[model samples]
Target: MIAVVQRVNSSWVEVDGKIVGKIGKGINILLGVVKGDTEEDIEKLLKKVPFLRIFEDDKGKMNLSLIDIKGEALVISQFTLAGNVKKGRRPSFDDAEEPERARELYEKFVKKLSEYVPVQTGIFAAHMKVFIENDGPVTFIINSKEL
Candidate 1:
């Protein structure tokens, strides 16, 4: 499992012109589930994401966490994040998990996250237009295997 976490002042996802998920002053997570991902991978991310001290403290140092600031999260499924682009011009998605299994893990991830803070999500397997106002332009790439 891999997550591209971005600090955002606000963000929303729209599908077919209808807004599906939205959040303010939080992190936007674009999650990808690879072929070998499991519940353990989900658990790893759950332990790290909320407590990440990427937000700023009163002294302008990056010391505050999402939980400390009581922020929300907008989680979106992004199978393309698993694409392997090292070979040719085209990206290969052979590492991405099957749709059904991916959906299950995605939902599980969201449910677990919601327990700690407000959480919203985009439709699974849908074409979405994401609008994000990045805060501090702070972003991080998290991989369960690395954690």
Candidate 2:
């Protein structure tokens, strides 16, 4: 499992011109489930994301967490995050998990995150147009394999 987390002032996902999910003053998570990812991977990220101290404190230091600030979350399924471009010009998605298993884990991830904060999600496997107003332009790329 991999998560590309971006701190955002606001974010929303649209499918076929209809908005499906949206959030404000929080983190936008583009989650990818790769082959071999398991429940443990989801657990690790669930523990880390909310508590990550990326938000700024009153003193202007980056010490506040999403939970500390009572923020929301916008989670989106993004299988393309697993694309490999090391060889050919065309990206290969062989590392991505099958849709059924990927959606299962994706839902599990969102369920766990909702326990910590208000959570919104894009429709799984849909063609989505994401609009994000990045806060501090802050972002982090977390890979469960690295954890």
Candidate 3:
């Protein structure tokens, strides 16, 4: 599992012109589930994301966390994060988990995140247009394999 988390002023996901999920003053998480990912991966992320100090503190230092600010989270399934472009021009997704398993894990991830803060999600396996207003342009990439 991998997560590309971005601090955002606001974010939204639209599918077929219908808005499915939206949030304000939160983090926009583009998450990916690769082959071999499991519950432990999801569990760890829930604890990590909310506690990550990406927001600013009173002194303008990056010390505040999402939980500290009571912000929301917008998570989107993004298998492409695991795409390998080292070989051919066309990226290979062989490292990505199967769609069914990815969907299940993604939903579990969202459930776990919801425990810490208000969580929103994009439609699974659907074509979504995501609008993200990045805050401080703060972004972090995390991989479950690291742990």
Candidate 4:
């Protein structure tokens, strides 16, 4: 599992012109499930994301966490994050998990993360237009295997 975590002033996901999920003053997560990913991967992420000290403190240092600031989360399924472009010009999604299993893991991640911070989610497997007002343009790429 991989997550592209961006701190955002606000974010929202729209599908077919209808907004499905939205959040404010929090993190926007684009989550991907790849081949061989499992619940243990979710466990790794759960132990990291909410406690990440990417937010700033009153002293202007990056000392606060999402949980410390009582922030929300916008989680979105993003299979294309598994795309490999090392060989051909066309990206290959051969590393991505199957849709059904991917969705299951995605939901589990969202549900677990929500327990730590308020969470909203884009519809799984839908074509989505994501609007992100990135806070300080702060972002991080987290992989379960790397942690």
Candidate 5:
């Protein structure tokens, strides 16, 4: 499992011109599930994401966490994050998990993350237009294997 986590002033996801999920003053997560990802991968992210001290505090230092700031989360399933471009000009998604399994893990991650903060999600497997108003443009790439 891999996540591109961005601190955002606001973010939303639109599918076919209809907004499906939105959030305010929080993190926008683009999540990818690879072939070998399991519940344990979700566990690793759960332990890091909510507690990540990427948000700034009154002192202007990056000291507050999502939980500390009482922020929301917009989780989006982004299978293309698994794309590999190391070999040729074309990107390969051979590492992406099957759709069904990816959806399962994606939902599980959303449900678990919601325990720490309010959470919204984009429709799994849908073509989405994600609009992100990044806060300070702070972003992090989290890999479950690395954690």
Candidate 6:
């Protein structure tokens, strides 16, 4: 499992020109499940994301967390995070999990995130148009395989 976490003033996802999921001031999480990822991977990332101290504090320093600020979350399934581009001009998705397993883990990830904060989500395996108003432009790439 891997995640691209972004602090956002707001964000939303649209599918087939219809608004699907959206959030207010909070984090927008783009999550990916690789071939061997499990529930443990999702559990780790769920704990890490909201507790990340990317929000500013009293002195305007990045100190407060989403948990401290009581923010929402928008979760989107994005398997391309595992895209292997080193081999050739075209990226390979052989590292990505099969769609069936990916959807299961994706839902598990969403459920885990919802445990920490209010959560909204994009449709699994759907073509989505995502709009993110990145605050602090703060982004972090987290991989379960790394830790």
lDDT to native, each model: 0.98, 0.96, 0.93, 0.96, 0.97, 0.92
Predicted candidate 6 versus true structure: per-residue lDDT over 1-147, tens digit per residue: 989999999999999999999999999999989999999898788778889999999999999899899999999999999899998799999999999999999998888778889999999999999999999899999998776
Compute the lDDT of residue 104 as modeled in candidate 6. Answer: 96
Q: Give the worst 10-residue stretch by lDDT in candidate 6.
A: 41-50
As a whole number from 0 to 100, the lDDT of residue 5 in candidate 1 is 99
In each prediction, how many residue pairs overlap at the backbone (N, C-alpha, C within less than 3 A)? 0, 0, 0, 0, 0, 0
lDDT of 1 at 121: 94
Question: What TM-score should be assigned to candidate 2?
Answer: 0.99
lDDT of 3 by residue, 1-147 (tens): 999999999999999999999999989999999999999999878768899998999899999999999999999999999899999799999999999999999998888789889999999989999999999899999987785
- In order of appearance, the predictions have TM-scores of 0.99, 0.99, 0.98, 0.99, 0.99, 0.97
Worst 10 residues of 4 by lDDT: 106-115
Q: Which stretches of candidate 4 lie over 4 Å from their true place?
A: none
Model 3 stretches astray by more than 4 angstroms: none
Report the CA-based lDDT of candidate 3 relative to the real structure.
0.93
Best by lDDT: 1
Which residue pairs collide, candidate 3?
none
Q: lDDT at 41 for candidate 6?
A: 91
Residue-level lDDT of model 5, residues 1-147, one tens digit each, is 999999999999999999999999999999999999999999999999999999998999999999999999999999999999999899999999999999999999999999999999999998899999999989999999999
Task: Give per-residue CA lDDT, model 4, range 1-147, as digits (tens).
Answer: 999999999999999999999999999999999999999999999999999999999998999999999999999999999999999799999999999999999999999998999999999999999999999999999999998
Per-residue lDDT of 103 in model 4:
92
